[model samples]
Target: MSRIGRAGFKKQVMFVLTISSFIGALIIGGAVYFFETHQVKKNAAYLIQNTTRQAAVMLNDRLNLVFTQYNKMTDKTSLWRLVNQTYQEEDSPQKYKDILECYRDMKEIYSANSEIMDSLYFATSDGTSIPLYKDMIFEKRKINLEDMFQKNYEENYGYYWLNKHEDQVFPTRKPRYVVSLIQCFKNTKGEAAGYMVLNFKSSYIEKLLEKAQISENGYMMLLSDDGFLGGTHVEEKYRLSEKTIREILHKENENMEKEGFSIYQVPLEINGWILVSVVPVGDLVSSSRQFLVILGITILIILLIAGIFSLVSASMITRPIEKLTERVIEFQTNQNVSFPVDKNMGYEMRILAEGLSKLKERVEELLRQVKEEQEEKSKLELLIVQEQIKPHFLYNTLSSIKQLISMEENQKAEDMCEALSRFYRLGLSDGRDFITIQEEAEHVENYLLIQRYRYAANFDYSINIADDILKVKLLKLSLQPLVENAIYHGIKKKEEFGTIVISGYEENDFIYLKVFDDGIGMSEEELKELQTAVGRGKVREESNHFGLRNVNHRLKLYFGEEAKLVFESTYGMYTQVTMVLPKTKGEKEC
Candidate 1:
């Protein structure tokens, strides 16, 4: 045999191959371990974040439902009659009759959603606490209804949410913990008539948290500025510590990791409550540990095989290894590159290439999933904004209707109710996003009609659209908010009666819809501030220009950057809001 096939050549090749395989294994295995661990953590955090957000939305919706039910109940003529009746010092037949009627009404409302609610209490200024299921029963723990009203009703003008507490009003029943919504209603003279206390079952919220739980070890919790309200895990040991709660409350960051746990927090819009999701880091990366063990064993096996091959065919092995290294480098530089398996590249090389190919596919799949998730999140946010707008308008309109009924303007109230029905029917548009300009115009007309009844001599309005553009498609509720802003912020504030002109026209492949108000127009400073706010397209909790901001956001979302809201105002003279929409081809009603 030649010197190349002798002991010297074999020893040299074995040492070099052993060293190379060991180093390669460490480098590749470490990179994979880091990547896999990072991906696992990222996915866990994303899931937890979404869970917290969705929980908050669900809780908010439930809370809003309570308010909606409250509005409907309070709007009842019988309930209004009961609140208006003064409590006579002497027990009279009429007093008992009023109580009975009120109890029946409350019972009906409670029965509809009794699974979610514990009891409903309608407390009057005269110190009567009427429960839904039964008559007022005075127990040892007598809840002073007047004292409760005086303590909270005055501070919180409209409504407020209470923490979990024992059901004091219904002490005779089984001991049950509950969360309460306390709202005060006012009379025609703006004086407090009575209060409505709707107690929600705590177990219902706990169930919500349980349903929102992300993983076996991960759990969800409801928190407020004060502390923990409730959670999925009832055990003290399973619950998050006070320190973590405090940190979450004080920190502005929505997501944080502390004490081996990843925490995601979302604030509720209905109340200033917080929804929190907690997941263990160990649980998030538990699979990564198994992957690392398998990887290590595979690396050891590959190293042993390489050592054996080095003694047999060192040149062939080295050439293929160099080609593999070059391919890996190329892939590292450009992730779009594919690692294709070749029949001549040997079984081990082909297996490695296949692994690389699968990794690339997985990465691309994750990217696609992320993109879809982001789109869904945006759509959800838009839906939330739409929901927020609806409730405020409904509450205001219902209040107007209530006032009209109280004044006994039956004819005007009937007209307003009809207008409201039409307004909502068109506004909903069968859940379609785009509506014809004619339908949008009609929706705004109904809204204006309702406002006309509310502010009889305060303002007059006109909607003028070219006949040709009426069939063009536009976003639903696009003009109604602008019309509302013109009324309340502009016309209603002025001393003299003002005029609002809503005009629509098509010009140069774009449509211009304008709401012009001859009322208390904004000052230069105010105009600039309002413009900047809408330009940024972010909703501020304290801002009174939500209508304007919301409309501008929706416009930009659907119509791209070319679509915008143009504001023109001169202080104490006039304000005009023009919505610029890019006309889409083949516009038709849905």
Candidate 2:
């Protein structure tokens, strides 16, 4: 053959070999990419599925813990012991004081579990129930044991629900639900003596779901086996619908009865109580596209170095983008929202990002409106509070006089009436928010005398006004309500003989007035609620007094945030409320 013919043949062979090799590499890369992408999606799906199951298991465990706490708080043995101590036998003054102590201790136990308790009650056989957990109060009422207690026992024996008022003990107007179980107490003869009720709040159980650390975008819910109970902290729309939940009820109910784990593709049935976990599934699988893009870029660079497999690398790049596009579409359809991506994305990615900016604008507008509305409401409420004090003083004064006249102490009572008049008149003395400690102390002393006459030595109070603090600037009426709470709930409720000791002194560039009382000390839960109420300045009408909330509010309003109230209490013994006041010059330490 001629030399030129041979050379031409060699070139044709080389070109054919290179093209074939590039095609082979492309085919291999395509196969690997497809397989890896499938594996990634499967792994992501598996992660989400397993996490859902685990969350379900944890949720069930937490619900069981809530039940266990409810039972513990409502234990018949302890409650009956309390009932017998309080009612069955006549108790000495000291013994009665001890009972209050025990009640306070029980409050601690319930307080520790308040996360799951809406409100707990100690209902006596006589139909009087005192709220021992949360801040619940029920007025004494006539109730039929069989109709209220027995019926509730049958209805709530083995289930949980949004609680209706068990009976007249809880008024119809209150907005609290009781998730409770009852335990029957026996007398010495083993007859049914009385019952102890364990009540949990719906919000408390919701807090349990919240505390489980469910993923921010994912949530697990506890549904009744019968489909009668269900709630979630996640957004409302994400919550499983009744139709969807009822569908899995059979399986859920069956699982609740069974002794082990239950799995079902369908979430509803009569026997199927479910742990339904919903997660943002697309967020979990984006790693595959990231890996594919990285792999394609590396292959393209390697091919460019030798012009081998360049076609294959380009095909690899296009393949991943197409797969990612399909996933974005699937996610959009399932979630009923556009994919959260940028609008300026390349032509292939524009669909996901188009409506995002408009959504952002709408969200911002909504937030702005919400903020303005909140501020306006706060201002209006504050104005109303400032104007409402006049009526409150007039009312408390009239009640005090009515009690004194009913007792027929016409002479000493007149002086008290005069003192009450003087106390309110002090508010007009200075338009300034601040007043002297002496003036504040006098206000409390007048109030205390009126209470002393009403409670008739249920409590004894002592005051020591430090000479230095007497003329120092203090918040008006700051000391009165704390002293009043000590007398009413702490002393009168628990002790026939209660003593409150008040002292004022200087400490660390500040003036402190200490009000310590040997009254019925509060349990941990009451103390927590009291602290929250103080912090938020919220007053509950059922908490037996509106004065403390108002007093604390005024103190914070006047004292520049540093002058405020602090308290400590031990059940059945003593509670101390401290007023922190900034010191003024020329204050003598008394």
> Highest TM-score, which number?
1
- Evaluate residue 277 in candidate 2 and report its C-alpha lDDT on the 0 to 100 scale: 43
Of candidate 2, the 10-residue stretch with the lowest lDDT total is 254-263
Cα TM-score of candidate 1: 0.43
Error of 1 at 504 (Å): 99
Against the hidden true structure, what lDDT does model 2 obtain?
0.58
lDDT of 1 at 252: 77
Per-model CA lDDT versus the true structure: 0.77, 0.58
Candidate 1 local lDDT, 114-191, one digit each (tens): 778788878776566686644335354545645665645555557777877777767755677888888877766777
TM-score of each: 0.43, 0.34
Local accuracy of candidate 2 as per-residue lDDT tens digits, 1-590? 34554455455446655765555456555665577667775676566556656655654565466556555645544455555545445545544554465466457657766666554445555443555643655554554546434443334443333332333335445655555545555456654545655665556545544554433454545555433332444566455556555555544332221111122222322123555544444433455666567568757654554454445455533553574566557755554444455433344334324444355456669979889757754763554345335576567667877877888978767977887677666654456455678887887787777667656656778899778657777655567767867877788788578788999999889877888988789899988887777776544444444566666665555455776778798888889988776664323221
RMSD in Å for all candidates: 27.8, 29.9
Q: Candidate 1: where is the Cα deviation over 4 Å?
A: 1-25, 76-97, 133-140, 150-156, 172-174, 185-193, 232-238, 287-590
Off by over 4 Å in 2: 1-34, 49-78, 81-105, 133-195, 204-217, 225-237, 252-274, 280-590
